[model samples]
Target chain A: MKISILRKKLDDKEISAVELTRLYLDRISAADKLTDAYLYVNYDGAIKAAQSAQTIIDAKQSRPFTGIPIALKDNLCTFDMPTTCSSKMLDGFVPPYDATVVAKLRGQGAVFLGKLNMDEFAMGASTKTSYYKKTKNPYDLTRVPGGSSGGSAAAVSVGLCAAALGSDTGGSIRQPASFCGITGHRPTYGFVSRSGCIAFASSLDQIGPLADTADDCAALLTATAGRDIYDQTTADKTFDLKKSDKGIKGKRFGLIKELMGKEVDKDVSAAVKKAAEWFINAGAVVEEVSLPMLTHAVPIYYLISSAEAASNLAKFDGVRYGFRPEKTLNFFDMISKSRDEGFGWEVKRRIMLGSYALCSGYYDDYYKRAIKLCGIIKSQYAEAFKKYDALLSPVAPTTAYPFDKLPDDPAQMYLADICTVSAALAGLPSLSTPCGYDKDGMPIGLMITGKRFDDAAVLSAAGAYEKEFVRKPPQLKGVSEMKL
Target chain B: MKSDISIKWLGNLSKIKFDDDGLKKMAADMQSIMTLMDSLLLVEPVEFEDGTEFCGLDALRADTVRDSFDPELLVSQAKDSKDGCFVIPKIL
Candidate 1:
């Protein structure tokens, strides 16, 4: 069920918040077995929070997310729950404080359903890297839900939660949402505070929402976005998310030529093109525009993101709040052994790659060169934005693939992130909305990106498209929409 | 390229060790990823104009004293702690 309808029913007292929470809890208990979407389910805490929400509603002091059940990507710290980042490195470690977004939602009386899973330290394109469990796409139990926000997408896709908070470094939220046939938004860089989010690629990581609709995502962002003194990178800006005012008349959209080219699957390209035709018919001008630097996005993203990740992840030395080796020689040996045992293969691969890029001799050749190319991609995006209101493209080259598909070459998986990383590199607002499905009935995502800080407009464009396109929920056996 | 970008060297730098089997797997994985990294060679070495301004010291907030997490609360999260301090291996 959508948050808007739930809000009305909750206000009318037809169904209590506690009842709603129980319904979702029951659904998760039934469905999450196959999806493996949640890392932890705070059953007692959710019920306790819902009782408080009922009290607030009775007194007529309900906040925007009052009584609403929502889940969080495991990276976001919740003082009451473990913030593992789906890695054993921080297993059983509960943060002392809530993340900025979590604090905001708690203040709004949002009931925390639980923490969802993700790629270990947000490293891989699929949640297969998670140390706990690999989240399956709700649409097909065998296929992966793209990561590192795979659990967030899967949970929201199957209605395990009303919505979920996810962090996007390199298409983590968007790609997974695309694979799961849900709406996800990666707010412009610095738009959302990342104070308590476990650092992945600090520069590119921005927490956003995955929900059933673009308007629902906007509601979550409206509550969480703003400057926090703790995170100085958060922009001193705000967005007016007027759900009723979202319209596409007289706007311009650029169909990114490189994203819809021969390299993309025919079914995926067809869906995106059909979305363009929809925009054109709805009084919006659509054109094919080229941004050649986009070809360099995947490599540039890997180099820059990994370099930053190497620096950001240096604090996990096993002495403080995470796993420790059973036996060790000394201080260095202890730290190394703990990290080796704690982290998974993907995390180690990224750390090695990142350390290589940042090494003394290779810094200028790899890291600095990638930064310069990143600047070029930013300029190309700025030029394109001058001619268009928003850009449209496929979220990924194809739909979600089966597990163990990239066993030999992990680079093949990273290369597929080309369609979404340019927006992250440029700090632009981008979202993935379900456009259509492939021949195999797998969902395809149409990504809509706009200029930095033009997040409201980007969402409005997606909302406009969503009004015409009816999203199909996963037909998995246990998945059922709430009758309320 | 595999020899030049040694997995052993990278493992040492990253403070990660691998057994023989792990080393073999890592080498094969790194080689495949390095092939992707080679695409970086195609990019021209031109310095594109970036409009980022240095937000020097002024960007920082005022250093006003505020409440911090209690020492006991902070230390309680440590894997091993005693007397409000984290317990680590003694350094020589």
Candidate 2:
């Protein structure tokens, strides 16, 4: 059910908060066996929160998110639940406080279902790198839910939660949401605060929402977005959640010529074309625009993000809150052994790559050059935005693929981020909304990106498309047949 | 180009170690990624156009004293804590 409908039911007292929470927890108990969406299930905590919400509802002091059941990606810190980031490096570490977003949601009376799985330190595109269980696509169990936000998207896809919070470094949120057929939005870089979120690439990481629709994403974003004293990168502006009556009528959208290349699956390209046609038929203008710098977004994003990640991750030296080695020779040896054993292969690989990129001999040739190229990519987006209000492209080159399909080379996997990385590089607001289904009935996502801080406009464009598109839910194995 | 990158040197810089097999695997993976990074050379180093968004230092909130995490709670997550201090290997 949609958040709006849930609100109406909650307000009218058709069901108590406890009953609603129980229903969702039951669904998770049954369905998550196949999906493997949650890392920890906070059954008692959720029930206790539900009781509190019931009291508030009885007192007529309910807020926008009162009684809402939301799951957090494991990267977001929670005081009570473990925020492992699905990595052994943080095997048992729980923060003393909640992340800024989690705090906001809790203050508004949102029930904490559990922590969802994600890529280890948000390193890999597929959640396979997670030290925990791999999250499977609800649409097809054999395939992966795109990651590192795979668990968040999968949970929402299988009705495990009303919505989930996900972090996007390079296509993490949107790619998984696309694979699972949900709406995921990475708000403008600073639209949401990053305080207490386990940093991967500080410059690129933004916590976003994965929901069934754009309006739901807008509601979540509105409730959570604001300037935080803790996160200086947050914008000073407020996210005023007003109705966007300004539909796609007469608005101009650009179809990025670079994104719809031969690399994109024909069905995925077709879906984008169909979305453009829908816009054109709806009295909007659609044009093919070029951003050639986008072709290098993959390399540029990896270089810069890894460089930031290496620095951000230097804190995990085993002395403080994370996993520690039992036997070591000295302080240096302790830290080295702890890290070498604690981190997964992918995490270590990125750290090594990041260290090399920032090394004295290679800094200018790699990191500095990537930053300069990033500037050119951003300028290209600026040029395009001067004419078009938003751009349209496929979320991924293809629909969700079977496990172990890509070659062992990580570059082969990183290259799949071609379409979504540019928006992140430019600090633009990008969203993935289900556009069509592939031959195997897997959903394809059409990415809509707007200029920086034009987040509401980007969401409005997505909401417009969502209103007309018919959404179908995945038939989860044990839970779909059960009537709550 | 791949041979020039020393895995041992990077492992030392990152403070993470690798065995012989792990080193070989890390080297191979590093080579693949570096080859991908080489594509940046294809783009001419055009004049830098600082398109990065900046909130500026002026936007920072005034630093002020406020209640912080309770020391007891902060130290609770540490693997080894005694007398409100994290127990670490003695550097000396």
Candidate 3:
């Protein structure tokens, strides 16, 4: 059920918070092995929170999220539950405090559905890079749920949870949501605070929501967004939860030319074209928008994200916190061996590339150039915004590739985010709304990106499309099949 | 082209030791990524705009006395700690 309907049910006392929490927990226990959606299940803590929510409900004083259960991406710090980032580097490390988003959600009396799995430190396009279990696509168990927010989207897809929060840097949330056939929203950068979430690439990373619908995503974004004194990057502007649909009447949307190349899968391109046609039918102008600088987005994003990651990850040297090698050695040697063992191959690869980029003699040639290219990329998006209210694209080139179809080279996998990175580079509000299915029946997501800090407009615009064109995915199996 | 020697230097800088096979894979991967990165060479010079006043570095809070995590809680995350200090290997 959607968040509003579920809230109404709780308000009417049709079901208690305890009963709802138990239902979700039971579903998670049943299918978590197949989906690998959760890294840790906070059953005891969820029950406690539900009981507290029930007290508030009985007294007739309840918030919008009072009895709601949310699956949080494991990267966010939670005082009680483990925030592993699905990496062995910080295995079993629980923070002393909650991330600002966690604190805000707790204040709303939201029940914890435990820490969901993600790419180790939110690094890759696929959960194959996770140090823990590989999450499977709910649409097809043989395929991967896209990462780094694979489990978060998959959980919401299969109805393991009502909504989930995931961090997106270069399309983690949107990519996974596309694969899993759910709605995921990456809000304007700096609109949502990032304090206490484990850092991957500081400037690029923004925590976002994955849910069953656009309105659910908007509600979750409302709960987590707003200013935080702890994270100075946050804007003080409040998120307007009230959605207004102008419909596609007089709405001008650009079909990003670069994103709809022949390289994109046939059915994926067809879905994007169909979305454009729907807008045209609604009396809106649709034009092919060219942003030549988008080609550079992938490389620039990789360089910048990895460079930031190297510096951010330097803290995990085994002395301060988390997993440490038991072998006796000097301080430096201990740190070296611990990291070598602790981090996965992908993490180590990025760290090395980042180190090389920032190292002497190559700093200007690599890191600085990448930053300059990022500025150019942003300028292209800014120019496009002058003509269009929003831009459209397929979330990825194709739907979820089979799990066994692993690429040996890391660069081969980086190609997956080709369509989704440009918006992230510009700090825009981007979302993936499931539009249609591919020939293989895998879901295709229509990506909509609006101006920076125009999150409400972006969300409502996409939500309007859902109302107009009811292109729903096939019925999911497992828990989602269970009639709630 | 990414040199094997330079990558070895990079591994040293990153403080992660690689076996011979690991070194080969890292070198090949870095080389491929760098080749892909050449696409950025076409873009002209550009400036990184500092964000708005409320969201930039200048908006950071003033340095002042503030509450921090309890020392016990801070040390609790350390795998080995004693007497308010993390226990690392010998330095001197």
Candidate 4:
């Protein structure tokens, strides 16, 4: 059930917080065997929190997210649960304090369902690299749920939780949401605090929400966003959460041409076209706009992201809180063996590439140049937003692919990030919602991006399309019904 | 493009080792990718200061600990803890 539906049920006293939590836990028990969405479920702690919330509800003290069950991506530090990031590196590491987002969600009396799985250290586009089992697409068990927020998306998609929090460095949330056919919102950079999230790329990371609907995502975003003393990068401005049906009357939307090329799957293009038609029919003006820098976005994103990742991951030595190798014949051996044993192949590959890019003699030629290119891309997006109220595109080239069908070449894997990287570079707000399905009955998503800090407009436009669009996925057909 | 720079140098700085074949393959792959990225050089040069940039680090406030927990609590989570400190293999 959606967050709003749960809120209504709670308000009507039809279900207590403890009851709702048990119902979701039961649903997860029934469904997550197929989806593999959670890395750890905090059964006792969640039950305690739900009982506390029940006490508050009995006393009629209701908070915004009171009694709503939410899932956290494993990268976010939770004081009471293991935050593994689906990696052996942090297998037994548990923080003594909660992430700022987790603290806020708890303050609102939201029940923490569990820590969901993710790409190890939030590094990969698919959760297959996770040391834990792969998160299966809720839409089709044989296919991958996209990552690094794969489990977060899958949990909400399969109704294991009311909503989920995910971190998006480069389409981690939006891409997975699209693959799962759910609504995911990546708020403008600094809109949500990142104090306790395990760092991927500090400058690019933002925590977002995945839910069944745009309105639900908006509510969760509102609850989680705004300034935090611990997170100096968080914005001081507040996001207005009440759904305003600002019908897209005379709003200018640019359909990014670079995102709709021959590389995109035919069904994805059709879904985007249908979304554009819905916008036009709703009285918004649609025009094709060029973002030439977008052609190089995937490469630029990889270079910069890897460089940042190299520095961020240096903390995972055989020291302090993480996994350590028992064979410490020497210090170097200790570090090497710990990393080799703990990290997956994909994580090690990026760390190596990133270190190489940021190394002396090559810094100016690769890392510095990529930063300059990022500046250019940011400006290009600014120029486009000046001409358009928001931009529209396909969230991914295609829907979820079968688990074993992915290409062997690393560059081909990187190519999967093609359409979603530009907004990430600009640190702009974007949303993905189900628009249509392909012949295989897999869902396709339409991405809507707004100017930086214009999260409301992005959500409003997405909500408008959601209300007017005709081709939504049919009622919850569980994974067993999928052809694959 | 510098001949003096070898995969050994890169690997040393990165703290990871690769087989000779892996080094050669990665170098060739990265070179081809970088060559394609050379297209960005064709864009008209604009004054860097004139462009809209992200809100700078200047906007950030000085670091102040908003909340402090017992350091022992943090040390307790470490795999190897001794004398209220995280123990690591000697690097020196």
Candidate 5:
């Protein structure tokens, strides 16, 4: 259900938070068998939290997101559950504190359903790398729901939960949300506090929400997006929920010339072009712009993110926090054995590449040059932003593909992120809204991006475009409007 | 593929141990990924200073002591601990 409509229902006492929580929990239980979306279901904790939300609602103290059941991506630290990052290294490890986003959402009375699966340590483009079961797209069971926020997207798309929180680093959230046909937002870097979030790539990672509509993501950000003293990198400006008309008139949108090329599936490209055309018809100027450096986004992203990840993941050495081997002949042996047994193949591979990139002889050649190229890519987007109010593109080159059709090489999967990474590298705000379906009956995503710190405007433009998007997947079309 | 010695050295530096097959597979994977990254060198070089300054950092907070987590709380999370300290095998 949409948060705004549900808020009124909750406040009027037509439905208690406890009842709403039960409905979502039941849905998750029914959906889990098919989607493998949730890694852990915190039934007892959710019930207790819902009862508290009920008390707040009865007293007429409810907030925008109060009483809503929201699923958390496994990477967010929660004192009530294990924050595994879908990797065995942290299996069964419960954090003593909540992540900044969790702390904020809890203050607003949001119900926690459970933790959702993701790429192990948020490394891969597909949830196939998750330590738990792989999540499949709800539309077609044979195809993948993109990752590493695959579970978050799938759960939200299928109504397993009212909404969900997912982290984006190099398209983890947006790509999956596109594949699952839900709304996903990636706040500009530093806009959302990252404290207590298990770091994959500290510089690039930002947590946001995936839900039924752009307004819902905006509301989620209003509650959770802001600075935290704990995370020095958080931006100084907090997200304000002042309601604007969010009209599309008089805005200029850019369609990157490089992004519309042959790599994109014709269906996917056409759907985005149709969205651009909609803006044009709505009294907005639509122009084709150039960002040639975007072609280098994938390679540079790997170098920088991997380098940071290698350093960030070093803390999981079995000495403190997470899993540890039972036997060891020496201290070094203990750390080595724990990591070897605990991490999955993808996690280990990333650590290997990161170590190589940051190593003594290779540091300047690979890591340093990539950082320089990343700067050029950032300016390239910035240069376009100077001429355009917002930008548009396909979230990925194609819709969800069948698992058997995916390439054997990991690099091929990395290449799939070609369209989404440049925005991340540039630290710009971006989102993916379901535009239309392909001939194969899979959903295609239309991505909208704006300048750094121009997040609210970005969301407003998407919310304006979302009017025509009320046409949802056949299964989910009327689910949000269904009376409890 | 990376040289056998270099691959072994990287594993050691990263504190990871892989079997011979895992090592060979990882080396091959890294070689292919590196080949893709090689294209970045041809992009026109630009200036960028290496630092966290690009990310907006909040001004430093007051230095006054405040309520803090007990050391034992962190130690309790360790896989093995005793007497408020993490227990590990002897290095020597």
Candidate 6:
């Protein structure tokens, strides 16, 4: 159900927040076993929060997200719940404070459905690397839902919740949203505060929303965005996200040539092409634009992201908090054993590579070069945006891949990020909406990226395209559907 | 194009032991990947000084009496703790 419709239903007494919360919880109980979408469901706390929202609704205190059920990706800190990033390293770590986004959502009376699963420490493209079980795509059980925000996307797609909050660092949100056939928005980096979110690649990370539709994402962004003193990087500008009938008329859009090449899956390219035709038919000018620098994005992203991840993850030693080693011969042995026992294989791999990249002899050669490449990628987007209002691309190279068929080779796995990394490096607002389905019935997403702090424009373009071109995926049989 | 940096050096720095064969495979893979990255040298260099800025971290004025975390929560997960501190074996 859409948040706006849900709000009207609540206002008319057609539904109570308590009833809505219970309904979602019941749906979660039935569906989550199949999808593995949640790492931890806060049954009691969620009910209590819902009851509080009910009181607010009774008092006639209506807010944008009031009485709406929302799922939080496990990486976002929650003061009242365990904020595990689906890793044993933080298995029982209850943050002393809520993340800024969480605080704002709660203040708006958005019911917390539960904490969803993710790649361990947001490190992998697939949630298979999670210490918990992998999240299965709701559309097809054998296929991956994509990650590290896999669970968030899956939950919203399957109607476990109306919407969800996801962290996008290198396609975590957009990739999963594409795979799950839902709407996900990665706002310009720092548009939403990151205070209290566990740091991964601090510079690259941005909190975003994953919802069933573009308008829902826009509403969630309004509630979750803006500057916070605690998070100095957040933008000071306001994003007014009311439903605008502004069609993409006369706007110039660039179809990134690098993203549309022969390397992309044939079906995926066809779907995006169909969406481009829709844009052109809507009286907008669509032209193919070159961003050759995007070719270097993945490698540079890995270098910088892994280097920062190594430092951010160092704090999880057994001494202060998190998991501890059962036995150790020395202090150094204790720290080493603690980390070795705590982190999963993917996490360990990143930490090792990150440490290597940031090591004394290699710092200037690897980390420094990667930082420079990031600048080039950013400039490429800036130069492109100077001529175009937004850039259109495929969210991923292909639609959702079958769970068992994922490449065992890490490099091949990294290649899945081919089209999405440039926007991440440039810190631009980008979104993925389900454009069309492939022959295999997998959904293809058309990614829309705008200049920095241009979130409203990006979302407006996506909303317009959604209205003109996209068709909602037919509800899968045997999944009990909920009515607003 | 891929070079095999000695495994002994990697093993020493990472504090993980690898057999000669394991070292050879890892080195070969890393070298291949690094060789790919070496292609960046040919691309025109971006003027780094223009847009680069340090983020997240800030040098704020120190607070001497800031609120500290509960000492009990700190050692709550430790396998061994005593008298407000976690006990560790000798390092030196």
Residue A155 Cα positional deviation in candidate 1, in Å, after optimal superposition: 0.7
TM-score of 6: 0.93
lDDT of each: 0.90, 0.90, 0.86, 0.82, 0.86, 0.83
Candidate 3 global TM-score: 0.97
What is every candidate's C-alpha DockQ against the true complex, given to 2 decimals? 0.63, 0.72, 0.61, 0.42, 0.59, 0.34
Best-first order by TM-score: 2, 1, 3, 5, 4, 6
Fraction of true contacts retained by every candidate, in order, equals: 0.66, 0.74, 0.70, 0.34, 0.70, 0.25
Local accuracy of candidate 3 as per-residue lDDT tens digits, A1-484: 6898889889999999999999999989887877888889999999999999999999999998998998899999999998888889989898999999999999999998899888888988778788888888877888989999998988988888889999999999999999998899999999889998899999888998998889999888888888788888888777765744455579788999998998799999998899889878878899999998787788888889899999999999988897788884788888888888999988998898788778887788789998887777887888888899989999999999898886886777887789998888888999999889988888899999998887876788788787766655435454456445
Q: Candidate 4, residues A263-355: lDDT per residue as tens digits?
A: 999989987998899888889999999998788888788878888988888888767778786766777877766776777767766776687
Per-candidate total of colliding backbone pairs: 0, 0, 0, 0, 0, 0
Model 6 lDDT per residue over A71-134, tens place: 9999999988889899898888888779999999999888998899999999887798899798
TM-scores of the candidates, chain A only:
0.99, 0.98, 0.98, 0.97, 0.97, 0.98
Off by over 4 Å in 3: A243-245, A471-480, B46-56
Tens-place lDDT per residue, model 1, A1-484, is 7899999889889999999999999999999999999999999999999999999999988888999999999999999999999989999999999999999999989999999999999988789899999899989999999999999999999999999999999999999999999999999888889999999898899999999999899999899988788888887766678843557899989999988778899999999999999999999999999999998899899988988888787788888778888789998998888888998998888888889889988888889889889899988888898899899999999899999675557788788999999999998889999999999889999999997778888889888889889877789885667676
Error of 4 at A71 (Å): 0.4
Model 2 chain A weakest 10-residue run by lDDT: A475-484
> In model 2 chain B, where is the ten-residue run with the lowest total lDDT?
B49-58
Candidate 6 off by > 4 Å: A243-246, A470-477, B1-36, B42-87
Clash pairs (backbone) in predicted model 3: none
What candidate 5 gets wrong by more than 4 Å, as runs, is A241-246, A474-482, B1-5, B48-55
Model 1 stretches with alpha carbons more than 4 Å out: A243-246, B52-58
What tier of docking accuracy does candidate 6 attain?
A: acceptable
The 10 consecutive residues of candidate 5 chain B with the worst lDDT sum are B49-58
Prediction 6 global C-alpha lDDT: 0.83
The CA lDDT at A447 in model 4 is: 93
State the lDDT at A56 in candidate 4.
Answer: 80
Over B1-64, each residue of candidate 1 has an lDDT whose tens digit, in order, gives 3367778888888888788898889988888887898788877968667763212214577889
Comparison by TM-score, 2 against 6, better one: 2
User: Could you give candidate 5's per-residue lDDT for residues B2-91 as a string of tens digits?
Assistant: 354377788998998888998888888878787777777677676754232355654676678788777888787887789888887788
